[model samples]
Target: MQKKLVCNTLKVQWRTAKLLIFAQNLTMGTIMAKESYSAVLITQGEHRFYQLAMPSDVLSSCTFVSTRDEDPDKGFQRLLDKKRAKEIATYIDSGHGTIPTSIILSAQEICGLEYDSRNKTISFEVLSGSFLILDGQHRVFGFKLAETKIRVPVIIYDGLSRRDESRLFIDINSKQRGVPSELLLDIKKQADYENSEEQLFREVFDKMNGDPNSPLFGRLSPSKRVKSKISRVTFNAALKSIYPALTSRTPGEIQEILSEYLASVRDQIIRNGGDENILLNSITFRAIVSFFIHAARRVKDRFGPEYTIDNFDVVLGPLFDNIQIAKLSGTSQSKILDYLEKHFKGEFQL
Candidate 1:
């Protein structure tokens, strides 16, 4: 079998050697032509590691060794999910796909890795079935199954004890917290605005939060949980429902309108001895933002398109006066929206 494999490899080398060289050069200096890979060495505390990009085919060809506590010969990784791998493969095949996260791996002693202190790069031979995967098995295999080849970020730890390997795997799987969805939205809103309505409202949302005089000043949590602030996710969901209304408005104008509307609501609730912090609650806030278009429409029909905070304030007068919205604070978002809709459309004088 070994002899047959060697003969086949020699036959394929004549055809593939030039393509392999092209691939090595294409990555600009990271991948070496002689089956060697190099990357900058990064040190954190007592541990040394290399952060590099590897072609998925090369990485997936490396071995996966699982650890078992009873038998040290086996390794620590979880069983691979072929379904998840296939999904990733599909995404990779898609035109706009990206896998930005680093795939963690550990190298054995036999791989002939060397660190150059002068250049601050670690170079290593691409030994078959040598590097043990620590995390991202699915991603690696996904690339293996994919027809499209791409460079994937990788972290290689050169020397780790078996015990340390198990610990590292456990730490990575159990200790890490993913970035919040809301935070991702906020980041996307800033990084790729392109005059999108979603991005516009996000800017308006930020303005409302940053302005000292706005009713929501310092009271909107874009990323993490704050004690008395509304979540960005909830705010985003509410804003998405009013996309048509937001299409024609600028960020500054939207900010002013929302700030005034919120101020009026705050004033009405507080003067009527309602909970002053009612708007801070997610359910109440969602309903208010959802109700924006309705209030705006009423104000526009009664008085022209030159809508102001007072217009929304007067239009929403029946809502606060007739309905005790402060008491509906602890309800579900859908329930709160429904409750307000009944009053706003039917019983209220709007």
Candidate 2:
């Protein structure tokens, strides 16, 4: 059966050297997709699997969703504000000044492809149950509610495996906002998340709050909402100090060690008196993280790689045990930092 050309919005382009050399057989390495959905696919990259797909159709056939680092298993996140979505829908349906922005997606396969020599077009078929949105959740949601026919533009990365998808999710989520969240929850899930070292810090930050056994669970405040008073920015800033030495550890490994340290030492510090959440104090958390790095770096310099996580508690445990908060109530955070810093440098080994 001939797949229908619903509109002329799709323009075929290729980014592959091999495909360009064999222009006559452009679809040679293409994956076969569904018979119903075909697009003008052009390879324009170092890899054969990456292509530009212009699907000249609305989003009615597709589903829209968001991911959360806090919990991917939790139900999909809130869609665009209904009022905003409706406003965008009106503009889209009206078809005035509608130069559409692209929504990005990643999918597992391309079932089939065939180059149309006569019409100079390329038709593609995407395998079913394989579409995941990496960016532009709102634009897709807006188009879905449009009243009139509108062919939404899409950039779909084809032939991506699950691992590839997760990494791509992190790359896109780190620099972009109001998008994907599962891959790097600590930062990607938060609206104010940043890139570079902060990305690593955010991942570890989120893990401490979201991981099941985390000592900081329900402690850090996410930018999207204020669940706790612990400043995500301040804590993340403090984390950057230790970021340089974190090269050899994965986020999980670091999270475990840090959380364990907190659990072991919480009893010694006077964060609160009774029935009060003293952990919400920004200065205390920041001071603790900063001093840990100061002490850990010293340990690393002396012990070299011999300082294993196996004995983290053996060495760093009692160091925190010396904390004696003179007064938890009305105590300035600066005093806490000074005290922690003194203790951190004073208690070098034990």
Candidate 3:
């Protein structure tokens, strides 16, 4: 039988944690070439791992999905000084800092991996758009920009939910004494004072952030810190979108209704493989929730005193049935206004 494979298999170890790593013998310094490789894919409780090597050949293809504070000028991970990367590169080229001491990285959706674990090595092609750099954006991009190639190690956590990826990033960088992580934590606290709906929004955001079943879990920036993709500003804005409708609703009541709605949207997004895109943004979330509170009054009145998923979905089903996230993402302001006014024609009033 001709053994079918994509890339070669190799052995890897880390103090009793052994991995049958899949690797390639692609020529060094040819990072830009369209090359293919293989990986050892492992599945663990809603998470995937693709243990592989780090080189320009691989890093060049990987995307950087950063949780860094994005500045329009400096962009994500603004603290990543090119001078620092240059220093590292110079040290490497000088043959002194040959081994990267504590470089840590995490990635999502390794196209270079298989879905499940069967104890068999899987082959993966190293191609552009194969992965995302959840952490270590500088070192990875630094090496790529440095005009030199060095083989570093990487932990490619394939098929990771955004929350898990964020957690891993926090774990790696925080333990490394990353100043940014500490600052983010500090900022997380100060965010509450900066806003009017901070109390209600924080409660809702915290529940969603902590709940594993929640789609927004791990994806919300609670500290206004450099964690997760979504920000507290977005969350606060979402509340403000529904602020007028929230006259009598407590935070817990709001949490229950939003949780169910988010779970549905999240599942739909994941099912469609739309997780990578900025699909669940402030506009869509705010608009949908606003529409729900505006339109679900019949259900609320009939059900009496409390809101429920059934009540939300009665209106949500008809409204959201017409709403496709991929199609509606980044929708224009006029369209959003039109959408809100359309279904809310006969909504229950506060």
- Note the Cα lDDT for every prediction shown: 0.78, 0.57, 0.56
Give the Cα-based TM-score of candidate 1 against the true structure: 0.59
Task: Please provide, for model 2 over 1-350, each residue's C-alpha lDDT reduced to its tens digit, 9 standing for 90 to 100.
Answer: 12434332222233355456566444553334343333445565532332333433434344345456434754234444677767777877776737366677765344344445455554445433345666666666666667665555666666766666666667766776653232344445464546667667777877887887776787666554354556567667667766777767988878886775566445444322232355556665666666666556655676664444434455555555664453332356556666666676685334
* Alpha-carbon deviation at 73 in model 2, angstroms: 59
Screening candidate 1 with a backbone cut-off below 3 angstroms (N, C-alpha, C), the clashing residue pairs are 66-74, 66-75, 67-74, 67-75, 67-76
**What TM-score fits each model?**
0.59, 0.38, 0.38
Q: Which regions of candidate 3 are displaced past 4 Å? A: 1-196, 224-228, 264-279, 323-327, 343-350
Residue 15, candidate 3: C-alpha displacement in angstroms:
95
Q: Model 1: per-residue lDDT, tens digit, 1-350?
A: 99999999998997699778878775654444334456878888778889888888888776465735534575566667799999999999996789899999988876667777776666665655468888888898899999999998999998898878887889899999888877777788457733575677678888888899888887888887676888777787778887778768788888887787778878878767888787877777887788777778888899888667777778778777888755568578777777777787875454
Clashes of each: 5, 16, 2
Judging by lDDT against the true structure, name the best candidate: 1
- The regions of model 1 sitting more than 4 angstroms off are 1-54, 61-101, 105-134, 145-170, 180-195, 210-213, 221-224, 231-233, 347-350
In model 3, state the lDDT of residue 51.
60
Error of 3 at 244 (Å): 3.6
Better of 2 and 3 by lDDT: 2
For candidate 3, lDDT tens digit of each residue in 1-350? Answer: 22333222212234223321221223432233333334556566666665655566467655554435663432333356777777766766665556554234443344445533455444444645566565566666567666667777665665556566557666666676534442343365565433445566667777777888766776776544443356666667667767777657787777777776666545545555566334356566665555555555756666774555555555555555444445446556446645545644635233
